[model samples]
Target: MKKILLTVFAITFFINAKAQSAEVAITKKENDTGKIYTSVEKAPQFPGGIQSFYHYLAATIVYPVDARTKNRQGRVIITMTIEKDGSLTDIKVVRGVSPSIDQEAVRAMSACPKWIPATQNGLPVRVLYTVPIAFTLGK
Candidate 1:
């Protein structure tokens, strides 16, 4: 019975992992500029840390009035270029929930302070970062 339970748990974990991988299709942008990289040796860090960044977003983000009124809720994925100077540029919506929510996500990201830029071989490089912002209505 112990062996059977362990096998079942392993199978369930594998299946769940596969399902999650299938749900998120990440297409890394391919470019030959030698300036922008999808994956670098060292990735950028948000001000303070990722947790602090989330807290900042939660505190600063204002849900769209139209989206709240329409009862629309989903995750909005935003892609932006973290420049070599720790500045963000080319902000865009990779996968948007709705127009209002999408706009808000972009707004929130745009308002972010500079980040610690990514590095490759001890040199700063522009890198692409994708962030998912979720919008949910209150109870």
Candidate 2:
């Protein structure tokens, strides 16, 4: 009967939807490349802790002499790819600024110290994460 078929279809649809929880959906983060995040497994830290990575970078960045933005201020959006073993695999610039400033941003990123590592389900999984750093001259 048409009524019986429609009822069965509706029930099946709901069952399938419930089975596939919304939270379990494979979410492609800003720059997801099918990578996971590393877990905390006790690693060495920079001289003054993980925060030192920023300090070291700020000290190394050299603004371009011809930078149009006299303010010399912009944000560098960095997307980092971490391996399961807690190491940097790839670094990409998502939202980039001027070419000159962008290059400096990449240099600073490459010079960054090891991260504290990220985790998923309490296990070390490679993942891609985006981090933004604002650079202001003489700030």
Candidate 3:
């Protein structure tokens, strides 16, 4: 009974911690030209959809030769602002594995076509978006 209670307490604590962190992130403010939102009524979408966006990434990302040779593999987290006009700006790597790999991920994202801008209260608004690109080596 004690073990079960301990497990339940741990789970509840973890969940509350996670929720708090997410709330903080969603409430973060940006000092850009216009107000940038982290949460929106309708999120921005790729031309076709999420699947098409993945297809675009797969076709555009070129694994850096140096990183591949050095056996560096990990996920790069990128953050960008999707503008009200459906353009992307302020592309940055929030988490990176290596310089070359990170740059490659940025390059691919930079070359992407415009996305459908996010909406809030029935009007288009700029929103902060994050994506993770993974680099892995095949056996």
Candidate 4:
């Protein structure tokens, strides 16, 4: 009976440790002057929320003619810093399928309007945000 109890306690401790570790996996970065967080108390948002953001992307992203002709299709991953004033900067492609498509993705993201800006401890803060844009050719 004592052995069984010990084993159960050990299992519970490990389970709790695993859960805490998962929670700690959220990315956060800080600096002396300006801090950039990937996970914050409140995330930056588009003016009209996520659906509107997608709509904006759809309306803005024009498939590159060269890429379409070359049958280039894939998702382009982009990362940008959302400033305290909700402006986006440091826009770049983390992953790309082709040059034209990559450039188009950057163009679309760069043209987006200001976001709501992320918050930490109830004050506006800059955050690094990543977005993936997909380019698919119709069948």
Q: Which pairs clash (backbone N, Cα, C closer than 3 Å) in model 2?
A: 35-126, 36-125, 36-126, 36-127, 37-125, 37-126, 37-127, 38-118
lDDT of each: 0.69, 0.53, 0.72, 0.72
Off by over 4 Å in 1: 1-34
lDDT of 2 by residue, 42-94 (tens): 32233575335445654666667766456556666877665555566578887
Q: How many backbone clashes does every candidate have?
A: 0, 8, 0, 0
Local error of candidate 4 at 21, Å? Answer: 13
Between prediction 3 and prediction 4, the one with superior TM-score is 3
Q: How close is each model in CA RMSD to the real structure?
A: 11.3, 18.8, 11.0, 15.0
Against the true structure, what is each candidate's TM-score? 0.75, 0.59, 0.78, 0.77
Off by over 4 Å in 4: 1-33
Show the lowest summed lDDT stretch of 10 residues, model 4.
13-22
Q: Report model 2's TM-score to 2 decimal places.
A: 0.59
For residue 95, model 4's alpha carbon misses the true position, in angstroms, by 0.6
TM-score of 4: 0.77
* Residue 134, model 4, lDDT: 73
Q: Model 1, 23-85: lDDT tens per residue? A: 232334446544566666677888797656766677667878888788998777788988888
lDDT head-to-head 1 vs 3, winner: 3
Worst 10 residues of 1 by lDDT: 13-22
